[model samples]
Target: MQNFDYCTPTRLLFGQGVVEKLPEVMSRYGKKILLTYGGGSIKKMGLYDMVKELLKEFTIVELSGIQPNPKYDPSVLEGVKLCKENDIDVILSVGGGSVLDCSKAIAAGAKYDGDPWDLISYKVKAQAALPIVDIITLAATGSEYDCGGVISRTATNDKIGYVDPLLYPVVSFLDPTYTFTVSAKQTAAGCADAMNHIMEQYFCEDSTILNDGFMEAGLKSLMVNAKKCIEDPEDYTARAEMMLTCTYGCNGIYSLGNSPTGWPLHGMEHVLSAYYDITHGVGLAIITPRWMKHVLSEKTVDRFVKYGVHVFGIDSHQDPFTIANQAIEATYKFFESIHIPMHLKEVGIDESRIDEMAKHVADNEGLENAWVPLLRQDIAEIFRASL
Candidate 1:
């Protein structure tokens, strides 16, 4: 076991009909509110009307049109303006993780006079942020339960994952029913995303059996429930379990006492999504197995063996290298089985920018601390393999 410290302060209201608790949770944040959401998804689902009705008593200041991968330009700037002009005391994010993530950035920027990018780029620390209360409609990102949010810089092709303990949501309402209408592709992508989250943690250099067990169980749960969900979108039992699995994906609970594994897959995928405007989770799914294959070695082969035997029931009698190779293949197969594109070309990501993205990831991302430290050349090779 490694020396570590952990804490999670987000209060989760999970299950069907948990949205009914929104008014009470919003009440503690204050009267004036900055209601944040994405494009018209909520309106289409009638959730927009429901949330507005529930919070009818509060002074609602609306800030809509947050996008996936959550840009920092207009969205963050507009959000900061809204918070400053309305003197908003609370931020109520009502869509997926994108909206909640944008709201988290807005909350912190509203309290700071410096550019919000300063906080995101680690040039400045967050002093405080407006309290956030969220009603989550998506399960993939885990931003609702986590203190961090990945924001994209459009001009620079940079996606920075900003974390501040102060940004943990005061309350998060998760209702699986709200996710019933999600498209099959997104559902599969979400499952892959959650699985990758656990895999990233489980692939750590410094780990304990306790965390590995938690991560393996979480991965199995996501794999099982996701298949059931894609087959029958309304299977409440499967949907509920999958929702909870994604909810716990990135927060510190599973690896509470373990040292940070440095989330290398996320580091690499950030550039993919940030540059190509791809779905964050989908990019992760495409990149993970390739990263695993590239990083596997004498030192890292055991982690792959454990993951294969535990998560996929791979034969234990095989040589360690063979088991590890099969494990990587199994990961790619899982992504493909769920109808996800396993290659970058399938996703319309051409090879032209591979070198550029590799350099960006190497220079900007914190990959030196990864379980298998990666260099710019190694990153380029992985991107080529992914292509």
Candidate 2:
């Protein structure tokens, strides 16, 4: 185990009808609220009315139409403007991870005088930020439990994961009932996203057995429950488990004593999502197995063997290389079985921009420092294989 310091201060009110506690939670942060959501899905599901009725005593400002990838220009800028102009005391993000992610930027930017991009890009550090509370409707990204979010600059084709301790949500209301209406496509993609989070930590250079066991169980649970979710979106038990799994995904808990892998799959997929505006989790699903194959070698075969045997129940009697290859194939097939588009071309990406994305990922994401360091050529090859 490695030395570490960790804290997750977000108060979680989990289970059905938990959003009814919104009024009591919001009271601690004052009455002026910036309500953030995406695409009006909350309204369609009647969650908007439920939240509004609960918080009827409070003043509210709406920042709607936040996208999946969560753009910086309109969403972040408009949110910041609302916060500053209204003296917003707290932000209530009432949608998926992207809304909460945009709210994080807005929360920080509300305190800063300069452009929010500087803070998001790490050009400037945040000293203070507005308090954030969220009702997560999607199981992906895990932004509600983490102090980080991926933000995209569409014009520049740049997507950056921004993290600051101050960005953690003050409160997160997790009612799995809200996710009961999630589509099969998103449920599968969300599973892929959360699973990749574990693999990112599991494949590291140094780790404790405790963490490895936790990740292995998490991977298995996600794979099993993700299929359940696809078969029946209303399975409360499966939805709750998957939601909790995703909540733990990106908060550094799984990687506490582990050496960093630099999250190379995310590094590669960020370019795909940023360039083509594809779904974030879908892009991750497409890239993960390809990256796994590219990075496989003698040094990494042991990890793959353990993953195959423990997570997939692959027979352990086989040679290490065959086990590793089987594990990679199983991963690909799992995503495919869950209905994620398994190829970049299927998602409208082609060779024309492979070189561009590889170069961009190399220059920006620093994949060369990943666990199995990847050069631009290596990343390009993985991209081609994914295609």
Candidate 3:
């Protein structure tokens, strides 16, 4: 096993009716809260009213319309403006991962006098940040548990994953009931997002049997529960389990003591979402199987065989190449079963920018050191295969 150090400081209040505890949690930070959310889903679900009623005693500031693939421009900049202008003490992100992700960037930017992009791009490190507490409505991205967020610069077509330990939420209130009203499309996309998180870690060069077991079980659980969620959006057990699984996805716990795979699929998919502004999880689903097929070889077939046998229950006696190919096909079919667009063309991306996007990914994402070591041409081939 590889050496590792881990800490999860965020307090989790899970289960039904946990939002009632919001007052106590918010009290720990202060009364001046910058409440962040995306669109008006919370209002539609009545969560907004409940939160307002609970925190009526505290001073509230609002920053809404934080989009998915969270934009760095208006959302982050406007959030920072609100925080600075209001002297905001804490951020209460009441939507999906994007809102929380935007809140995280705002939390850090609130403290820094320089441009927030400097901090996000690693040109400078933050010395302090506003405290963050989140009520997550979507089960994807695991931003509530992890100390990172993906921010997009639409003008430049750059989607960067900004990670800093100081950005971890001080508290996360997870009531699966909040996700009961999520649409089937988003539900499936969220499942795909979380499953990719595990697969990225599972396909690394070095890992323990324990880590493998965790990831294998996680993959199976997500596949099963995702279908359940699509069929019945309010299945508490399925939504609850799926929510917890995704919450654990990006926090590095599943791959504790495991070697990093450089998260190659995410590297490829980021360019897609950055360029086309497509759904993040759908991009991942489309890229994952193609990337897996491109990377499978004598050196990697063993891992694929294990994944096939353990996660998908492919016959262990099959040839290693056959098992690997079967595993890849199974992955593609699962995404298609969940109704994710399995091709780039299906998602409004065409051949026009494939080469440009591929070059950008190769140059920016550092995929040369990935587990399978993809170069520029290799990335282009994968993009074409995805098409």
TM per prediction: 0.98, 0.99, 0.99
Candidate 3: which stretches are off by over 4 Å? none
- Show the lowest summed lDDT stretch of 10 residues, model 1: 252-261
Candidate 3, residue 15: the lDDT equals 97
Total residue pair clashes for candidate 2: 0
In angstroms, give how far residue 373 of model 3 lies from its true place.
0.7
Evaluate model 1: give its lDDT: 0.89
Which is the better candidate, 1 or 3, if ranked by TM-score? 3
Q: Candidate 2, which ten residues in sequence have the lowest lDDT sum?
A: 252-261
Summarize candidate 1's per-residue lDDT along 151-171 as a digit string, tens digits: 998999989888999999989
Better of 1 and 3 by lDDT: 3
Which residue ranges in model 1 land beyond 4 Å of their true spot? none
The digit string of per-residue lDDT tens for model 3 on 162-280 reads 99999999999999999999999999999999999999999988999898999999999999999999999999999999999999998899999988789999999999999999999
**Candidate 1: which pairs clash?**
none
